[model samples]
Target: MDVPRGFSAIESSAEIVNMPLSMCCDWQGFTYTMSGWHYLCEMLREYKLKPKNNYRKSILKKYYDKYQPYSTFECFLCEEEYDPLRHSTPWVPLPWESAFRIRLSDNQHFGPNSNTFIRKEFVRTISLYHRLESQGYQPQENKDGYIRGHFLKKGDDYRFKVSGGQHRMAALGVLGQKDLHVKIQPDWKRVIDIQHIHHWEHVKNGTYSEEAARKIFNFYFETTGIEKAKKYGLL
Candidate 1:
């Protein structure tokens, strides 16, 4: 393959579905592998080294909001009922919705965005989805019901997180679908926490404001007629 000046061309066709332009040329990721492409993408996801907020924003701009929101409203990814505000039951503060997605195929970041966790069931679902995909079946997603999360510009790294679609994302990860859809809530930290999604009530430095809290409780009340929200845990 005739190569250019700076690009480290992937001569191996076994894994060379798309070629991402290298940072040596100051490009974001694969020139040919735009996110919408059916296969995995290769983008520079190394937010740790390049911690510049602009680069993080660029990733969000380039990859996020490409798809529309889901039409039908539901509580959270685990919940099935149509409850827009996710507070009906004291569901774990940080369940699947609190995870940040890491698309390993996107060569944008230098190393993997670490520390994100998922349920064991997530893996099983991925295998199922993979089998279905092999049978020529791809699932559907939308704006309202798609993965909602954030890729925050943090200390020498951008944190990839989730607001919904835990299982769907796991399937993508299992299938190596790096170039997929994302709804990045840049201010997600202010509203959610991946590390402490299950323990938010104890966090003092950043807590969901009363108005937001009330709104969620209101959702709970509307769904199940519960007036009081859960109490804040002891510090």
Candidate 2:
């Protein structure tokens, strides 16, 4: 599979170590880990916030409307008549839809799909939480035997960006596991420079200058990253 210019598949032997859960991040390099599911679990536990299916649809429609503009392709959600599942061409999200999904994930609103998938994930997250709580997180049980990712170091602070086993990582996080056994790839530092991560965060927070953020974003994701960032006003 082709990756971005600045990214590569994990090819080197990974070093396994126990690292703090708070230091781990999702694939987008964000510190927020399964926050949406966490929120759902909390609501269920504390407030019994279960609404009817129609009510759920009403809530999800708001999110769909908000993120639909960011979609570039004629997916089933956007096009009233087009159905990619039946078409000869396999549909994939373009940069715009990808950007839309990122924002949706950040807000704990999984979409570009119906509420069914989101609800399924919520159920799965709950299942995972119970399994981890009972099973005690055995690394050997996982196919990879560990949560796989790479460590990004900015000065003394480190963040592990998960490349695999995100669901399990999120489960551990939700369970309040302070640390995890992780497999850190050796080539991450060479592919994703720490400075790039720093600049990206600065861009997200509107702390970095546009010119500088563009340069770093371009390096990380080529022109497409810059375009998405600008479209979302992150740069």
Candidate 3:
């Protein structure tokens, strides 16, 4: 994946842990695989996140399909969403995790007792995560010394999508972590219900066209430019 400009794997101060929602009931699982990562600029501000194009090929799409299977995340339909994973440059591999790179992408599904199929890139990246953890590394903290995500309310269902820290979240999962700390995305539901219209609440009008629906989203957040994106965007 391609990383953003000035993107670097620096220390995150949030003492947050993001885990899979499937840990609860009514979710699916798979054979555990390591995890993956890409260097990116630190999220200096708070706002919602989205992909630029190819929603069909986005990891965020994968996340939504996995977690918020029933609910409709209309905002995600924004064609202007930026795919952070799309512009990443793989950092040099660390040690231990790199050793297991050969075990990636087990297409045979032969691995056992895991939630995901281990892949080389994930093996290497998660290995770095653990390596840093071994050195007493900690997750960047929110204002409460904990980092988390916003949950979008779709009808009666609530969906929490990972914006910036997808790699870290997956790493913690493979390492068998629990007690992930996150807060709801502030104003998310309100933003969804803009214009006092349920239909306009999200981009669920059978398609996504940011140009046509920018007001619904842009009213509460910024679009997809660097300087303006972070003002209303999330990680």
Best candidate (score: TM-score): 2
lDDT of 3 by residue, 92-207 (tens): 11110111121222321112212343233334444555563574225443333333444323233333343334445444444455435543334333112224333542234413
Q: Give the TM-score of candidate 1.
A: 0.27
In order of appearance, the predictions have TM-scores of 0.27, 0.50, 0.31
lDDT string for model 1 (45-104, tens) is 322234343433433223322311121112211223323464343322322234333343
Indicate the residue-level lDDT of 70 in model 3: 14
lDDT against true structure, model 1: 0.29
Residues 1-235 of candidate 2 have per-residue lDDT tens digits of: 2322111223333366666666565543323233322223332232224433332444333333333433222221223322345333323232111222334342343345556665665566557767888998898676766777765444444455666666677667656677766666544442244455434444445333445333332322222122322333333
> Which candidate has the highest lDDT of all?
2
Q: Show model 3 residue runs off by greater than 4 Å.
A: 1-124, 132-137, 140-148, 154-157, 183-197, 201-235
Cα lDDT for residue 197, model 3? 36
Following a full C-alpha superposition, what root-mean-square deviation does model 1 have from the true structure? 20.2
